[model samples]
Target: MTNVVIVGAGPTGLTLACGLARQGVAVRVLERATAHADGSRGKTLNPRSLEIFADLGLAGELAAVGRTHLPFRKYFEGVFVNETEPFAGARRSATIPYPASRWLQQPQLEALLRERLAALGVTVELGADLVDVRQDADGAEAVLADGRRIAAGYLVGCDGGRSTVRKLLGIPFVGEGDPEPVMVCGDVEVEGLDPGAWHQWFGPQGAFMLCPFEGSPRWQLQASPETAADGTMVPPSLESFQRLADTHTGREDIRLGNATWLSTWRVNVRMAERYREGRVLLAGDCAHVHPTAGGLGMNTGIQDSWNLAWKLGHVVRGLAGPALLDTYQEERLPIAAWTLDVTSAGMAAVVKGIDTPGIGVEVGGVGDFTGLSLGYRWSSLAAGTPAGGDPGALLRAGDRAPDGPCPGPDGAPGRLFERFAGDDFTLLVLGAGTRPDLAGLPGHVRPVRVEDRDGEVRRAYGVTGEALVLVRPDNHIALVTPATEPGPVHAYLARLGATG
Candidate 1:
């Protein structure tokens, strides 16, 4: 029996599989599709997801194959309105190393993740659809389409919006769908169009958009029909796409060529009432479905699996109790709810003409979309109080651990992120303080004492004196307290049963 069985070999399932396998946990992945999915549906990878990829050693590969610094050009009634690169002004700061988002076709991104998982000696079982699932106290067993029963300690549904696991679990996905202004999107080749910019056209007819997909000759084509008889959407086709372009842009010079993939999308905003039911859980589109306005669907799913992987690993290893797994829903459910609102609001703004195309649609600013601003301040795992005093102090428990330059083992220069590269809790000790006793610490927790030589680490962590910051396996700050008082740190771990 495998330690965990992940359904849906998309980005979420593959990411979780890799994370758990890296920690020496046995994981199996299943996909209902007979083959890998292909498309540019979710192309934009936010900065926070990039950071997670960096920890997994795939950042370099992603950056190499991804496109960045592309400008979004908007036009109205065949007249050029304006152009702006939302992330152009973004610069890498001391704490935030990656500030720009990258665009890579979803298929390419999934390929990279699948490659990494293959290296880890795990292969996704394709054509193995999950027919049903049943769970008991010890573990869960899944029924496949071919009548094969596979048992695992845990089961995660990463399958898309039409999640069979969610339906079987009977989780209520409550929300409303936009009735009007349906969109048809697909990958197509075009002539007489510059691939340098994300082109958009909003006119009396409707809206049309074409974004260049990096590492390919195809562009992602999205358009809203001006008129659908009886509110019926037209089937996706090259001719239909050309008609949308010609109608919206009022130009016949541009031509649409072969199409690789095409599909119709409607605004169906819904989220699962809960993320987990006993040993079975949900991730990605299985848990939440929202408009693709902010390009957050896939990114959110990636983060979901990343967050769950560590907690699940701890439980599987017996280093923590099963209750620790509850934090998965506790920390991620709110985020999913928040993201839905953001995207729905963006859609409403577009409909009301209050927001410009590709601008002001993000949940916050560009920083927020990068996933860095997301934190679990209310999570049961997060514990600590701000030291209070420095007005610039921002570090707190349940926040992302800011990356900064620090002293290395030989008193040379290193980075805080370097210390948190592994799937272990990192204890970052700032300034000259008595190192916390690690002999009693759990084996999953790694302690690294850094001399705050230039006050860089101290400033980043908002610590004036000796302090200990407990960084979780997922790189979020779990506890922060003065080194003299390590009781809270130990206590926090004990609550999760992390202390051996």
Candidate 2:
């Protein structure tokens, strides 16, 4: 029997498989398609997603493929409007290591993750047509189209918007959907166009844009879909896209060649009522789907898997009971709800700014889109702030732990994220070297004592006095307690079934 049977080999499934595989949990990633998908679906990896890749040890390969510093040049009827680099001000700092967003096609990112998962001793099984699913308190069973049954401790669905696992589970996907398709996108070879910047043309006909990828002949094509007399969207094609480019730019010099892939997107702001049902759970587009305006679709799913992995790993390893799995839904459901609302508003803003020539309108850059501001302050695991902890503290329980300069175990210069990376719950003892007696603590809950020599970590963490910040494996602040008190620390661990 496998520890977990994950349906869908997309980024979310693959990432979860890698996380569990790192902990020696048997994970099977099954994909319905015979091969991996190649598309221009999601192209932006926000700062938070970049941090996740860093933790997975794929930072070097990911950075090499993602392009940053490309300015978006706008055109109105073939006239130069202006140029705005979205991430120009996102500079690296001690607190924020990956401040800039990286632009790469979804296929490229998935390819990198697949390679990493393989290194971790797992491969995605192709053509896995999961037809049915049944679960109980003990475990879940998956039935494939070939009349084969695979039993596992848990099942997860990451199989895109139209998910089979979710359907089999009869989960309600409640949200607002568009009556017709909204946008048409494609990947195509371009001619006579500058690849230095993302060239966009806006007109009364609608919006048209071509974003070039570094070291690739293909560019991502985006345009407002044309509606037919029946009020349905006309499917995207090479010739149809050419017409859109000509109509929007009012120029015939530009040409689109060899449309490799094409797809249409409808306005979908939806979420599963619950992420977990007994031994089965849902994530990624299978759990929630929002507007692509903020480029949060793929990033949110990547984060969802990251958050669920550590919890699921704990349960599979017997370190924590199944109650820990409940937290996965509790924490992620709220985040997904927030994503749907924010992305919907962001999409409305994009439509409102379609006729404007100024670049002041924020599309997918800045603010919460970077994902640094997101936290689980309301999570049961975070356990709320300490009894006497400041309610208005800058860094509170359930917040995404910030990065800052710190000393490593060898007393060498290093960063806090470097210590937080991997499959361990880090108990960061801040202010002074007041390391707690971790003798009876779970092996995964390791302690890190860092003296605030230059006050870098102190300032980033917003801690003025001696404090113990318990960071979860996914790098969220589990709790913050006064360093003088070790009872709360021990009690919290016991709550997590980590008593030694």
Candidate 3:
């Protein structure tokens, strides 16, 4: 009976629920677990994710808890080698406000999102296991394990790598894992180690790492996965961790105990063949998974939810056609593909060179791990994107919209992000010469006339005088055309069925 029934309560599901609930969409988030997930899953939040969280009004909260300048200290046989700051020389301009990444535990991020969802009048329904998903042309029904059926206009699967909804839907998750387990990971208390830096010890055998969590006594311990003679990965334990430390670091005095969230990780890289299946769709790990090296899993999933939330909200609210839902896959599926390739290569590099294996910028195979360069230029929703370039403009349609200084509603100076905030399409009419053909636009479109104050707005967007840029609710550019020729804007809205 709700507009959306989101499966799983991880960061992806919670973000979707928050976006929809904020837009007055009746949303229900069902989680199979009885409580929030624990462990230091995907501790790094990239710059693009910071921008999303900022839009969600979590910038201050995340900054308060996030460590932006954690340095990676390396060692060889427990002997200090060299240290490196991952985000050294990162730039921060008006366009890239959150230029650096932050390290915060996954559970803490989930808690913040859950708090935001509660503020929007929606709570995650835990202890609810989905057994089946059925959908017709009109709506979808989630069949719970306890014989409860929750019907909604649409359903999204945001579950983890082993997604039940995806399996039930028969969507093929095509990819492979390493021949054996790649690493053993857990959160444990380490004695005789500095909790200030990410301590790593590399040897001829393999590499062992223990990253200290902010304001916590426990550290995330990762080491080469132990295999039995029969070739089965040995389960993680404090004793196993101690053995790894002793073998790699020759540190017999250091003790490890109070282990939690123990598990073995593999260099598994897989993605759903498709993101959408009829009225049901998948996001986050439900759609794709990456290797444990770069911590790109949760960030990719959260961005997937961000991309889908607004489109699904529009369709459910009768503001756009069902075809709009197809763009979700068109846009995010390619991103998943890119993430898998880069992260897989990065993991391989890490395994091949353990003595001085690279991290962050050194490891990303093709692009940066910050998730800033991701886009969907091929999406059908990205209308009016020309084949050629404007020498003066650096951005095209479907690019992540950069933030910059501009005039507010009352002609007061403000940033573009303030206008882009909320669940609405921001139509930015820049400069005095731009045309004002705002009639028949959808009610969700918020048109703002900016003076381009001090040329900051134009510089960030890389646009010239008299330009109209339509930004999507997820803060991606939908269309960019000259103000003199505004037909593209109207035509694009017409294609989206957004005309009033």
Maximum-TM-score candidate: 2
**Candidate 3 or 2, higher lDDT:** 2
Query: Model 1 off-target regions past 4 Å?
Result: 179-181, 226-231, 354-367, 388-393
lDDT sort, best first: 2, 1, 3
C-alpha TM-score for every candidate: 0.95, 0.96, 0.95
Candidate 2 lDDT by residue in tens digits, 1-500: 99999999888888899899998999999999998888767888989999998999989998799597788888876688898887888789888889888988888988988898899889999998999999887899999999999999999999989999888889999998997777888999999799988998776666888989988888999889966689777789998898888778877789999997788878888899888888999999999998887788899999999999999998899888778988888888988988888888888777867777754235633238888899888888876674256688778889889998777767788888999999888988886657665567678888888888666776777776777888899999888777887778889989988775
lDDT of 3 by residue, 36-75 (tens): 7798867888899889989989998998885887788887
Among these predictions, the greatest lDDT belongs to: 2
Residue 307 accuracy (lDDT) in model 2: 94
RMSD of each: 2.2, 1.7, 2.1
What is the lDDT of every predicted structure here?
0.84, 0.85, 0.84
Query: What lDDT is reached at residue 142 by model 3?
Result: 98
